[model samples]
Target: MVAGIQLRIGILTQREIPSESEGSEERAKVHVSINPFPSLIPSELSKMSTEKERETHVYLAKLAEQAERYEEMVESMKQVAKLDVELTVEERNLLSVGYKNVIGARRASWRIMSSIEQKEESKGNEHNVKLIKGYRQKVEDELSKICSDILTIIDKHLIPSSGSGEATVFYYKMKGDYFRYLAEFKTDQDRKEAAEQSLKGYEAASATANTELPSTHPIRLGLALNFSVFYYEIMNSPERACHLAKQAFDEAISELDTLSEESYKDSTLIMQLLRDNLTLWTSDLPEDGGEDNPKAEESSKSAEAQEH
Candidate 1:
């Protein structure tokens, strides 16, 4: 007779193991089985399989952005972008935008803090000034690195094709913004180089927009306004600034007449802003100058009256 022992494993059925007796006729039996852990049920297996489908990083990024936690938002967005799964073009674009926004915010913060540090230094608060300086340097270095990474992303993923008009326009516009911030915060030589780079970017964006979009498009008008500001404030060219401002204002007014009432209402604030810019830029021009340009004189008169 063979002695047998029964064994139960996990959720599997029980099986018997036979043991040899002293008699020569006794036989031994072998059992083969596979049993998953008792703790892993159907629901748990489903959850595990669906892990890649979870957009938790994206959700966290949006939440962090809403909370103004820019650094955390950047990290979350990076995690989302680096996932093992392939991303859609739209998703990649979103990641790029998130990085751009965070980098811009970081640059702006550093500028503000640097200004504060300068004020503190002027007040003879060496201790606080030193702390602020150190913090600002760290932020500047980190933001510079992030800016370079974003530029790479723009070049490689966002607008890999030079013929992609819309994407190229967006990329150059962002490049303009990045260089403008760099110009504002860098040393004299670096500032000049950054300013030149900024102008090049703005010009490229403007050219691409003019070629691909309508003259009265919001993007064209916005680009004109930005160029005006750049010329007036950064380049110290008041005449060019006034000319671009006038162009933007005229285009906005012309576009306004073609829109429906609802659309007109939606654009009213932008139109008002354009008008304000016209007035501001006109006032910035030399009172006794531009006598040879009749159009400029007429525009100046119109802007002065429109402000009321």
Candidate 2:
């Protein structure tokens, strides 16, 4: 005699069968269907190989950068660095330096924006303040993480290799920017320390650029402009600011004059910004002390008006 049998099935669950009937002593048979959704669970999904994870993060980072979501890009790149442990020393150093730049810029942007937000709050701009609060909070949280990660990358990767000239210059420049922003948004002690670091970084970049880059290099002019700002705004040293700005302004004007209008088009913004800085710093100098450059000042004002 044959015994009755029962079977049960459920989605993504094991099949169940009733035991054989006692009198007949018949055997029970059970079979499981293939899992239609194999990667449903977190564990299964996370089983992606390390290389794949690194590639995914790298792709995400590129997308984030294109979207101008710099903090997200930086974080994703950091993940790529963490997972790409098998990369060559040069590759790892390059990746770490690039990661540091993104993190530094993100942190600096947050610090600058937060400072502006505080100013807005002080001015009783409640509506704008409310609109930016969520964004400000998000950036603040990311900044805390970025600060720690930047130091780790520098200490572990950059310092070990001593970096190439270009990489080292970029590293110090970004480091200066990070500290400068930190000074502006944080405590007085940070201000002092950050000023010191900013000055040191700019000076190092300047020294490196003298050997590694041309006198007319855009990087050189940019470094000077930044250094001038650090002196004028952060250190409250107008004399030093004027000195650096004047040097940068002269170099930029000479460079600008040499380029064709078409070639100059690419550098218009940088030129305009350099002129603006020169005007700003010179105007702040003691009347007799500042070198008067009426032409440059007028040009900068015209550029400003056109931009508006």
Worst 10-residue stretch by lDDT in candidate 2?
299-308
**Residue 278 miss distance in model 1 (angstroms):** 4.0
Off by over 4 Å in 2: 1-56, 80-145, 159-163, 255-268, 288-308
lDDT digits (tens) for residues 1-308 of candidate 1: 43455556654555554434744433444454554655787788766654544377777777876787767776765665444344444454456556666776786688689779879988999999989988988887877787766666555544554445655666686677667656656778988998899899889998898888655554555566666666665676667877877776676677666765644543455556556766666656667785422233212312111100
How close is every model to the real structure, measured as TM-score? 0.61, 0.56
* Predicted model with the maximum lDDT: 1
State, as a TM-score between 0 and 1, how close model 1 is to the true structure. 0.61
- Looking at model 2, the pairs that clash are none
The C-alpha lDDT values of all candidates are 0.63, 0.59
